[model samples]
Target: MAGKAPYIVPVGPIHPALKEPVHIELTVVGEEVISADFTPGQTHRGIEWMGLSRNPVQIVHLTDRICGICGVTHSLAFARAVEQIADITVPERGDYVRTIIAEFERIQSHLLWAGVAAHELGFDTLFYLAWRVREEAMDAIEVITGNRVNYDIIQIGGTRRDITEDQYDKIRKCLNTYKDLFSKLKKLFLEDAVIKSRCVGTGLLSFETAMAYSAVGPTSRASGVTADLRVDYPYCAYGDLDIKPIMPTIYGSDVNGDTYDRIVVRIFEVAQSVEIIETCLDNMPPGPVIWEEKVAKILSTCKKASGEAVGRHEAPRGEAVHYVAMDGAEAPISWKVKASSYSNLHVWPIILKGAQLADIPVIVASVDPCLSCTDRVAVTDNGSTKIFTKEQLAKMSYEKSRRMMQ
Candidate 1:
């Protein structure tokens, strides 16, 4: 142990106690992590590559599989790319509907991540309460699109169906219900001393580092990096809506650019998304959801020219960019998807190095990383590897609480 290479520890693939299948390799000198190598390619399924050969009609569902939690973002990116390629314009009402659905996705996603973060940090009661409230959003998705996880309602030109007055009424009620609960939940998570002590100064990321590393979403915004697609670069009906892009420390302090800051950014955004959805609903206009006759005509119009298009959408995690190349056929020649998780996840080793092992889950959860998009693992350690069961970790946290009480 005198003059040896640092111990390299691999954190996942099928092994994270609180995350999906992404792998993290950390090089540690004694108890301090000196560097980290992130490998998120284990679960790569070439979904985007497959989109190249499938007809434009089939690519919609393929996009949905990229990230189950933010499937709508993927679909929207692909659909927008295709529309750009074919020069098909969506109706104003169609744009508003798309914005509503996307905002709904953001609200539920942030809530899910917040609950998971609470659970990871040993705050089980808060986790349960937050998730129970998030169910209202899930129900809304089900009522609107007949599915909760993967809506599959975004077609090539427009949505598969229009939002009914009944759906709008239900959503309004859900928002009101969420608003009250969110106020309570926000206070507990953002201002709780215990939560703040663990998260406030941990996982610090500077604004420059965030920009250099291409961080996005709450991860970037928490660090005071001005990068939000909805506000910085408007898309869809986002331009029509009033979005100030909530940053961290808005509750009463300046940004600490830490895990706590990231959590606060997300918590506040849940309310922001709710407000945007309400605006979209209030401004709703009547029109056909799908552009039926024009799609064929548009396809015919594109047959004479070969072109390509790119579409970018802000997902719950960050920016989702899609590249589509069309050869004037019914399908795209090639399609490439760069999920927000791809860039945001790379900042992990930088954030987790100095933190305690017990805090790893909370730090990882803070970014709301989407591991299904990038997954892989490798390990290097000289000592015996220790694996703890989920029950063991739960017991450890519980025992620690008991000791504190004693």
Candidate 2:
């Protein structure tokens, strides 16, 4: 028994357990993971190719579909890149609106992650608790942008809508509700026996390893890497505030970069987003929300412009960026999207090495893996495929998380 060999177990491609298809091969002895290799890009949508085929206006909408949760950041990054090339300055009001939407989206995303993480730990009550609290932010966003998931708000020059006095009141009320709930939720994640026992020592990623992998967003922050795109490269209304990256140390944790630390970092981030939203609403100036060009005019204008630029955003997962090149054509000559998961995914092998088999889902969900957003990539895979829908993936993720509780 002592001389028995480890076995290679495959965990994806057509696997129903993930939100998107990713094949993770594990070298394990008994139930303990010895090493791991991950292969992603299963849900490639050819978004970058799509961006090149359509006008910039169309790409704005297309980018929103990159990941339903992180769509606003996608639109924000693409719009900023196009604005840089076109030499356009967004209005003060537009910047404020963008900031508000961005923060609101962050709240929604972080809460969604929290719920998923909780579900992964087999704590469905907390999953429902986190999402129930998440609804306030969603409601606030729906009021501002008219849709919950993909706001369709950000444009090249500005946003599609602005906040009114009555709407601001509604948003403020929603914010108040979130603020009240965060304190309680924070205690639950940090102190609850079930969450702490399951997550605290699991999926450890060191600061050095995180830096080597170039991890972004809460993943890096939990490891004490203060590399937020908003702070390093200010865009949108992010320049309005002096941002500080939240770390697990802030919430009474050593910077272990474990699943619990990741949860703590997100909890702190939710509070930060609330503060940013308030500040943005307070200082917003009245002006045009977007450039006064119609859809047809936008395409014509794009066709006359030629340049190359990059735009980056602090997506909920990490740093989401887009590289854009225009060549005096209605459509882009070249466009590349780099979602946050692309960099963060590299840390998987390190974190999953010493984990147990049951910890696989917990560790993977710890990074908030968004394979769909990361899909429009250049890596080629000649592997076989499967037919798995988004709903099946969600169900699988939930079932796995619930099982982890056992």
Candidate 3:
């Protein structure tokens, strides 16, 4: 046993375990993981680089393509940033509409993640059931935004579409369906023996460690960190809604900060999203959904805008932020995005360490890492990829700033 050699196991760039292209290096002693490391820039799309050449109005549509599951997340965040820079106040009805659609996005995203998690754990029947139920949310999204995926409903100052009274009944029906299905979903995912056995004590992340890594969304909530942007820093009708962060303790269990706890947090958050949507609908304020109806006017305002501001939203994954700086130009001088997965991905090595090799898939899936949204920069020199150290990146950033100033 003393002379037994450690093995280096590589998973992905393209692996069955990972939904996205992320290379994970695991140092293992037999079945147990000794240490783990992951590289995320494998799927960088350069969305930010593209945004620098487009106006805020054009960039809003580009944001929708950031993540397939989070249809409104990026657009909403980007819109809010541009709105802040242009000093455009969204109408009350517009705020309510944004909140409603964002909650629906939460419902579908969580269910999709649940299905993936179930599939990773070899629970194909549960996987099928989860995705099947998720369609109701998708249908409701289509009913409101007229698209199942990439709902281009968000505008620079407000929404492109409004939830008319005729659409109310359809939305309510979908909410009622989820209300009925919620309990069954809880029982099937939480009370099942196999799920409990595989996920209960596996991939534990302590609150201290989670905070140290700056985890967000369900990943942090599972670790008992009460840091929901909806509660901490309310935006887009969240200020009017009475909502708190969902913790695993809601399940009548202490915070274990394991894969199961993450499951519990997300499952309960789906119910929370349902309540939030219902509340927004009930208190629906009557007004125009867009601040400026003319796209040309919105563009003109953005072009005249000369300031910087950050837009933060409690996306399904966690807090998504967009920083925008404009200087009387057609495009922003700077546009940066920080998706929730960026924060959560840092915890992978911590959680994967000491975990069994068999549990890698579910554990990785548990965090619900959206690498496409997280990856922003990928440096390649003449066809060769480059991985820069922290110090090197810092120095390069400083040099770039100086060149820009000159």
Candidate 4:
């Protein structure tokens, strides 16, 4: 056993457990993982590059495609940046609508991840149950935005759609269902012997390591790091609500920062999100959903705007930021995105050390990573870096389309 050699084991680029294409390389001695690393650019689609040619109005819709699950996250962040540069003040009702949608996104995302984690652990019943319950949140989202996925509700100044009084009854009905099922969910995930045995002490990330590595969302909160952007720096209706970071302590357990704690944090967060949406509905102010209703007027304001600003939102995974710079143009001169996964992915090597090979799937799924949202590509030709301009990229894309047609 002492003389056993460590060998590399690669997982993905394609795998059943991974929802996206990411290659994870593990160096293992027998069943114990000695070291691990991951590569993330396999699914990069040049979204930021594409935005260079589009105006803020057009680009906002494109942002919705960055991640299928976080429908409003990217659009909201991008719109906020444009709003700041254009000096647009969102109507009070718009902010409340934004907050409600964002919390609903959190509810669906956490539930989806829970199902994935359960499936990774071979708990098919739980997996099916978790996904079945998640439909309620999806229905609620559709009721508000008119689409279940890739909701194009956000716009530059504010929201494109408003929550009508008639819609409030259905949303509240969904909330009431979750509130009733909260205890059963807690029992199923936290009290089950199989889940507890498999997750209690595995894939540990200490508080210091989480902070040092800049972990975010439930990943950091599980480690007892009070780093929620919603609480630390409120935006939209979050400032008006009594929001607090959900920790393992909320589950009546000390912070272990293990896979189990991550589950605890997310389950409790669903309750927190419910409370937020209900509060927003009860006190939603009366006003326009968007600052400028006409696309021509919004575009004109953006074109005249000349400044730089960063928009940050507490996404389901963590803090998602969009940086935009404009100089009296239809399109922003510069745009960049930093998804929450970018901050949490680096801790893989630390957390994976000494974990059993069989536990790798659940450990990886515990982070609730969305690699498609975080991936960015750097082109290199003949060993030298190549940075393509918007025109060059467009030409190449057109050529590729022509070739495909042939």
Highest-TM-score candidate: 4
Worst 10 residues of 1 by lDDT: 371-380
TM-score of each: 0.88, 0.91, 0.93, 0.97
What CA RMSD would candidate 4 show?
1.4
- After superposition, the stretches of candidate 1 with alpha carbons farther than 4 Å from their true spots are 1-6, 293-305, 375-406
Overall lDDT per candidate, in order of appearance: 0.81, 0.86, 0.93, 0.93
Residues 63-164, candidate 4, lDDT per residue (tens digit)? 999999997899999998989999999998999999999999999999999999999999999999999999999999999999999989998888989999
Candidate 4 backbone collisions, by pair: none
lDDT string, candidate 2, 157-195, tens digits: 888787888898999999889888878988888899987
TM-score of candidate 2 against the unseen true structure: 0.91
Ranked by lDDT from best down, the candidates are: 4, 3, 2, 1
RMSD of each: 10.4, 7.5, 5.5, 1.4
What's the CA error at residue 219 for candidate 1, in Å?
Answer: 0.7
Report the C-alpha displacement of residue 26, candidate 1, in angstroms: 2.0
Q: In candidate 2, how many Å is residue 403 off? A: 40
